[model samples]
Target: MSIGASITVVAVGAILSFATHVHSSGFSVIAMGGVLMVVGIVALCLQIAALHRQRQMTAAEVQPPERTVVVRPPSEY
Candidate 1:
């Protein structure tokens, strides 16, 4: 997920975990929200790592190539 989406997920998770009070027999909303928040954090970390790698690759590709020239002594005057 993109950064924005990840942030949204975390926000929604936070709201669910803290803003509401719902009790169900099957599962806990707070726990679900915590899981979602963790997922969002993981996504965000992965995205950042991917972008960093891409930038490094781009920087490597953008560098100018080195050139070398050799001069030989003029043949017998």
Candidate 2:
């Protein structure tokens, strides 16, 4: 997921975990929230790592021009 989406997931998860008090008969909202938070964090980290790798690759692809030298013969008297 993108950074914004990841952050949104984390925010939603926090809201669910800490702000809400609803209890379901067959599911745990808090647990789900925690899971979402973890997923969000992991996704964010992965995205950051991927971006860093891409930047490194791009930098490596660029190179400066090679220098060249030339010699001329001496003029005859």
Candidate 3:
């Protein structure tokens, strides 16, 4: 996932975990939120690592300009 999406997921998870009080017999909202937060954090880390690797590859691909030699003809007397 993208960084923005990851962050949004984390934010939503935090809100669900802390901002509301709802009890359900089927599933736990807090647990779901916590899982979302963990997933978001892992995705964010992976995205960052991928970006960093891409940057390094890009930097490595760049090469300096090639040098050229110029020759002069002998001057006529």
Best by TM-score: 1
Give the alpha-carbon lDDT of every model.
Answer: 0.94, 0.91, 0.92
Tens digit of lDDT per residue, candidate 2, span 1-77? 89999999999999889999999999999998999899999999999999999999988888666888688899899
What are the clash counts of all predictions, listed in order?
Answer: 0, 0, 0
Predicted structure 1: lDDT? 0.94
lDDT of each residue in 1-77, candidate 3, tens digit only: 89999999999899989987999999999988999899999999999999999999988889667898799999999
Residue-wise C-alpha lDDT for candidate 1, range 44-63, written one tens digit per residue: 99999999999999999998
Error of 1 at 30 (Å): 0.4
Which residue pairs does candidate 2 place in steric collision?
none
Which lDDT value does model 2 have at 73? Answer: 94
Q: By the lDDT metric, which is better: model 1 or model 3?
A: 1
Q: What is the lDDT of residue 47 in candidate 2?
A: 93
Runs in model 2 with CA error above 4 Å? 69-77
Q: Which ten residues in a row have the lowest lDDT in candidate 3?
A: 60-69
Q: How far is candidate 1 from the true structure (C-alpha RMSD, Å)?
A: 6.5
Candidate 1 is scored at a TM of 0.84
In candidate 3, which residue pairs clash? Answer: none
Which consecutive 10 residues in model 1 have the weakest lDDT in total? 68-77
